[model samples]
Target: MTSTEPDARSSSTTSEGATSQPSGLPRVLSVTLTLAAVTITLLGLRQIGSFVGPVFLGLNLMLVAAPLFGWLVRIGMPRVVASISAVLAVYAFLVVFVLSLWWSISVLVNEIPAYASKFQELYLQLLDQLQAIGVSETMLTDQVASIDKQQIVGLATDLAKGIGDGVSIMAIVVTVLVFLSMDAIDIKRRIQLVRDAHPTVADALTRFGDGVRRYWVVTTVFGLIVAVIDVVALGIIGVPFALVWGVLSFVTNYVPNIGFVLGLVPPTLIALLDKGVASAIAVVVVYSVANFVVQAIIQPKYAGDAVGVTPTVSFLSLLLWAWVFGATGALLALPATLLLKAFLVDADPRGRWVNALIASRPGGGETPDPDVPEADEPDEDLVGVDGRADGENDSDDGSKPRG
Candidate 1:
């Protein structure tokens, strides 16, 4: 009887294993369907980016302003008042941001002729140097003169106009922001309802929100410091429209890895046009130093941990998001990447492997208290004020785990 009982138990265990582990075909089909879905989603984003872009931007802005909303409420303000105040604050900031971009474009357009004239002189000087070195100026002059300055200026103007076109959609974004602020006040209650049904998804989304807010806050502080220093240095050195360039620096700081260099181009070129080669070189030096201090020295200490992404991963995300959403995608790359990580990796048990590939420090080390919540438990230990669980314990500097 004992021998038969042992045989029956072994048989049941084998049957359970067979049921739990599907044949290879089902796994292959699942992966194929996931890829297909991702492809379709990307195609849809490209097709409707104009509409989607503003909404996404507005949502990000709302998340960034969450702390302000909380602060207002803490100071004895009613929820409605706090929400309205937060929305208005965001609206004002957006207006200023858009106007700054428009002003920068206007400055560039107005000064293109000056730039062209200065560039011609520089070209002549360069030709003289090349001729002195026994290179034929006849070929160089023809090539340089053949370069249509007007066409170059026109291309820049057209690009600026394309960016300016986004102003038309500002109304939609403001409307979304207004509604989001009001709804945000009640987001916790809504999440509680979802928690009952899908705790893991709710937890993942809450973590995403927290991560995005922290990342942007740190970035904004660094951007401001860099922008102020850049403007002051450029102005002192006689670079025209220093304010405009400073604003550009602040905006471009959103793009990872190479934004500071990209921001340097316009001001340096303008310096070359308005001043001379020496001034242009000086501008480059100032930008390089200031950017190094802020982005390299100060920012890394804060941003790396707040972002929770390795340098390699962040760089790849910049390219991927730019391809998916254009320039705006590049600007929002970090936050978007965080959201994707939370949903696609942390939210699913099967995607833990993907997390291993991405969740590392920028300096290359294991992430502390890595997010690995099971659906059944949903990380109840890391509960937020909203009652949603957050498995990710990202530090302000990412060097240590948070409580």
Candidate 2:
């Protein structure tokens, strides 16, 4: 009887284990479905990129302008007036930005034609040098014969036309900005409603907004510093359109990792055509030293700290978003990534573990392991109105001091 009972118990245990563990087929199917869904969603976003890009840009602008809106209200301005003021401020910035770009492109279009003779001279000199280095003159000519003065001029003209074509996009952005600005007056109330229903989502969104603001603030400050240095360096180096290139640097600074390269190309090419190879080399060296120190080395550390994302993640985000949403996506990659993290990872308790892979700081965005007992530490990122960590205080009673 004992032998029979032991056999029956072993059989029961084995059966239970078999039922408890899920089959691999379901897991594989689930993963496949998820990947398909993500692909479809991304394709949809790309399809509507024209509309979505401007809307996202407007949202980002509103976030950037939120502090000014808040300050106006705090100073006793009526809500409508504050909203209008905030919208106008954003509009002014947009107008200035568009005008700067237009003026720069206009200057470039006019200047490009004058460089026709110089461009041809450089082309011949380059061909001669290549031939001297054992390159076949016939082969080089066949490969690059189409490159000429007209082509260069046409490229510049096309760039200007592209800028002109973006006016419709700007109009959409402006309209969206107006509505978003008005809606932002009750942002705190809306956040509270979200918090009541889904605290994790609310916290994620709050972090997203804070991260965007910090990222932009750091980038803008560093961009201005870099721009000023670049302008001075270019001017000393006799590079034409120093101010325009400076503005280009400032604008591209919003694109992480590779923006300096984009801002460097135009000035270097002009230096080559206008002055010579030596001037081009000087332009390259100046930009390499200045941009490398400021944008590549110093700025990333502060930006990473501000946005709570590692440099690797930032660069990958830039590539991914740029592919997904085009140029505007490139400009807003960091913010878009923040939004994705908020919804996909932070909003779901189970997915919070993913943060460990992407967060800039150690222990940032991590949840405690359930199996391990840890001290109940407050997150530094979460602060109260007085700028102290939530539930933290100097008073014995743990009560916040009255203002």
Candidate 3:
């Protein structure tokens, strides 16, 4: 009877502990400290961006290539051989791509003076029209005179040089990827270690990784589609450096909300210079239609399930991460946000209310992958990019929830 009484007391204690909430003072103190720590961390990240940027870029690339690496291993390839082959293939592709883009940009930079003359002409004409509307010509002339063409040209050249330097970091990034791929063979062991220690943390991390991969893969595919269409359209409209602009389109596509507008500026300005107002307007229209059809209309359909964040969350995240970690953080904003959500919101039983507050829908944010048979169930094997189950029993094999 005493043993049964003890069991009854234990059950009641467990029930009470589960339902209890933190006192108001403790909860408030916890929230304040969390915000303070996050702010400090962001400041530190921004300060060390030069060193950290390339590393994160490499990590993201590794994640993207993880599926191919897993597939190679599944085909009975040695881990070292498979890793080398996969890394080399990616390295070669990036080399060709960056070289082609640099060539296009160099050609465009040399021809900017010719375009500048036309832009000056247009600016003067616009000022004249404004003068006709009772605006003082001297006042406009003062404004125009303050706008130094040389300064503008210098700024553009500096921007191009900066981007070129950023691309050169691929050597370091690729090196890091090689090591990461090598370590990936023991990923299951590492995950198991974490699972043994903290099962809930392991579960959250697995979901986070899956979400990041799905979002990036879908976003990258759509970005390529947008780039191709933009390149073809710009070529047809006779925009200089069409290929460079297209590449820019591809990079900026990762950035949410305002990226399309940012990418539109360069080619449109070039069109205005080389062609005329009509051609520039035509360039704008083409970009608008293509961007709208692909990103606005189709991208969300695929990304909706992959990325559970709402449009508002995405845009705010972009701004917040940009401020926190500068440009690199901005590019990886969504994934970073997803990780934060996994830890701070999705991991806790109390997190449902927090998730609902941030979600686009009333039901809450996490969405089921239609491609996966039972996405709710934790997959114990590596899943392929095409959503097929692989014949490996491993965790951290960079598996997606699909297939």
The candidate that wins on TM-score is 1
List model 3 lDDT by residue over 236-277, tens digit each.
999878888998888768554567876788788889888888
lDDT by residue (1-403, candidate 2, tens digit) is 9889988999999999998988656866866886798789878998998789889888888777777776675576766787789899989987777676567667777888999999889888987888898887788767687678798899999888756646767889989987887676555545545555576776677677778888888889998999899899889989898999899878767653556776788888888888899989998999899888987778777776677778888878778888888877887888888788778777776556666787777463433332333322222112111112233333422232334
Better of 1 and 2 by TM-score: 1
TM value for model 3: 0.71
How many pairs of residues collide in each model? Answer: 0, 0, 0
What digit string (tens of lDDT, one per residue) describes model 1 on residues 1-403?
Answer: 9889989999999999998996666777888998898789878887887677668878888877776776665566766787788889998888777677667767777888866767888888987888889888777768889999999999999879865755555777888998888786655555655666676777677667776777778988999999999999998998888998999888778654556766888899899888889999999998999888878666655664676776667767768877887767776777778777777766675665665566655223323233544343322211123222233232211223224
Model 2 misplacement above 4 A: 1-36, 106-165, 240-244, 255-262, 288-301, 365-403
Deviation from truth (RMSD, Å), model 2: 7.9
Question: Which candidate wins on lDDT?
Answer: 2
* Candidate 1 global lDDT: 0.72
Q: For every model shown, what is its TM-score relative to the native structure?
A: 0.72, 0.71, 0.71
Looking at model 2, the pairs that clash are none
Minimum summed lDDT over a 10-residue window in model 2 is located at: 378-387
